[model samples]
Structures are given as structure tokens and as C-alpha cells.
Target: MSILVISPHMDDETLGAGGTILKYTDAGEKVYWLNISNTKEEYGYSEELCRKREKRYYEVIRRLHITDAVDFKLQPAHLEKYDTGEIINKIGNIVDRIKPEIIITTSPGDVHSDHKTVFSWAKAFSKSFRNPWLKKFLLMEIVSETDFALPMGSFIPNYFVDISDFLEDKIEALKIYEGEMGEHPFPRSVKNIKALAVNRGTIAGTKYAEAFMLLRCIEK
Candidate 1:
């Protein structure tokens, strides 16, 4: 089956479901990525820095063995500035073209505004009646964003994918997002990434795993 992962930012797909993605690709499934936001100058990022980040984005995708990727090129962290309908239409257009059987996107409860916005858009565009080609919709959890959400909005994953074999590949892919990682105790740190995997794996009865909230699924 074909799969599509919608990310609010460059590194979120890696942070949230990199291992599962690796597993899918390894199995010869076509996996695509849709990055909805991009670095912008107004965000205190220089043109050179933005270019650097873009370069790494491609490298990360290559390392993950993704079949294809599309960047919406929207300004990062400023998704709220655009009209909701516009965002939905843009995402809908991509979904129409891709016709994926499964879609993985940001959780609605994520603390980041960009993530929240993208989740809403994904939900609207992937509605069962609206997109019959979509059989499953999975919500992934970003390390810092999902973990920091308010108690009432916490990410409670119900679906777990054992990623024991691909855990190291996930970490290696995350390393491509050089600017996002930090020392231990930081959510994006390599240590914490491994810790999260181990924690999820314990819950999943595996050596390592990735957890996702099943938003919707239709059995044929």
C-alpha cells in the first residue's frame, strides 16, 4: 500500500514516525512526504540558513528512502496567518494527486501552532466522505511538541508499530536535522529520542517502537 506522511516542518516526520517510515520503505512500500511549512526570513532565519536547512531536508529524505516529497513552502510557525480554507484546499489537492491508502500527520493536540494548523487541515481533507481513497489516518507525536501539550490535550497513542530493527536508522536520519538536535535532557536530543523509543517499546512488548494515535481506519 502507498503511504503519505504530512509534516508541519522539515524534521517532524523524522521526529514522529521515522522508524515506521523506514520499515515501510524497507518493505518496498511507496512512501511519500508532504512538508507543509518552510523556513522564512521573518522568523529571524537568514537566507543562507534557510538554504542550509533546505539542503538537509533533501538529504534526510534521501536517507529515509522516501519515494517522493512535496514542500508546501508555507512560512514556518506562521500557519495561523493563512486562511484555514486555503490550507485545506492546498493539502486536499496533494491528497487527490497522491491517492494514498494511509496518511500519517501531526496530532491535533500538538503544542506547536503550525502542527495544530496542519492537523486541522489534514483532518478536513482526509474525511472519509471527502477522500475515499484514504483507508487510514494516523496521528504521530512530535517529541517536544506532543509531550508539552496541556494535560487535557496530551497525546495518548493507541497504535504501536514495533520498530526494533529500524530504531537506529531513525536516529541516524534525525541526525540530518543538525540544527534541531541538542544535548541530553532536550526533547530533540538523540538520547531522548532513544529513550522515547524504548519507553514506547516497553508498552508495545518490543525492543523499540513508534506509537501513533489511530485517527481513522476503514477495513475493506
Candidate 2:
């Protein structure tokens, strides 16, 4: 079955679900990527810088062998006005068009306003589905914020897809976002990926991994 992955920024998918994507691809599932916020934001970037981030995003996808995709309309970061009407309609159209069995999105536990908006919009869109028979819905994590935030006593992971083979692919995909990594929030390099995965693995009892907040599982 085909799967749809929605990302707020360009590299987010890789930063979050690169391993998961690789696992699915290896299992012979087609992946459709929807990147919704490749925009020029003067508030946090110069025009050139914004373009660089967008280009880096493109590089990451290509490196992952994700050739068929759509980088849609520019949704503003943080203050992105959720056009529930438009987004709901558009997402329904996509669902109708692609008919994915699964949807993967950026997690809501994220502090990034743009990431949060992306998930919320995705939820609104998923509502319009003509087929609630959709098999799976999951929110993937980027930046490892959720792992840190979940208390040591009460953390719960609903699904675990081992990424041992594709770990390097995840790193290669992440290297595309050079500008943001060295600046703020994160170092944005392949190095941190190992550390992040290691930490997540420590919690989940694996060597390295990517975690997803599993949302829904429809009966097949």
C-alpha cells in the first residue's frame, strides 16, 4: 500500500521519518511526500537563506530516492494561518487522488509552531476522507524533543519500525539542511542524528531508531 508523509519544512521528514520511509520503501510501499511550507519568511530569514533551506529540502528528498512528490503552497512559519477550509479541501483531494493506506506527519509535541500547524492541518484534512478504512495514521518526531519531554516513568511508544539498515540514509538525508543545523535549535548535521537515535534507542531498547506517535489504525 502507498503511504503519505507530510512535512512542515523541507528536511523535517528525513529528520523525523527518514528511517521509517526507508523501511517502508524496502517493504515495497510507495511514498508520497507533501512539503507545505517552503516559503520566504523575512521574520526569521533573508530571501537567500530561505531559498537555501528549500533547496536543501529538495536535496534531502532526492538523496532518499523520493522522486515523485509535491512541495505545495507556502505556509507561514509559527503564525501560519490554518486555512482549515482550504487545507481540508486540498488534503481530501490528495487522499482521493493518491488513496494512501497510511499517513505520517510531524508530531504535535514539537515546539515549532510550523510543525504543530502542519499536524493540525493534516488532522483536519484526514477528516474529509471518503475512506475511513485508511489503515494507519502516525505522527513522526523530529528534533528528539518528545523523547526528552516524556517522563522516565510514563513514556509510551505505540509502534517501532527498526531502522538499522537505513540509518545512514537518514544521516545522508539530514546533511542537506546545512544552514539551520549550525544556527539555532540544532546543529543540523549528520553527527547529531547518531546521538538522537542512540538516545531514542536507549529508551526503546534498540541501537538507533526513529519514533512515531501512532494515532490511528483502521481495520483492513
The candidate that achieves the highest TM-score relative to the unseen native structure:
1
Q: What digit string (tens of lDDT, one per residue) describes model 1 on residues 1-220?
A: 8899999999999999999999999999999999988877877789999899889888988999999999988888788899988777777787888889999999878888888888888887567788888888899978999999998888999999999999999999988888689998988998999999999999999999999999788987
Report the lDDT of model 2 for residue 27. 79
Whole-model lDDT per candidate: 0.90, 0.72
RMSD of each: 1.3, 3.5
Per-residue lDDT for 57-114 in model 2, tens only?
A: 6677667766367877465564366566777678777877888888888766676777
Candidate 1 deviant stretches above 4 angstroms:
41-44
Instruction: Give candidate 2 regions above 4 Å deviation.
Output: 41-47, 50-54, 125-129, 144-156, 183-189, 202-205
What range of 10 consecutive residues in model 2 has the weakest lDDT sum?
Answer: 146-155
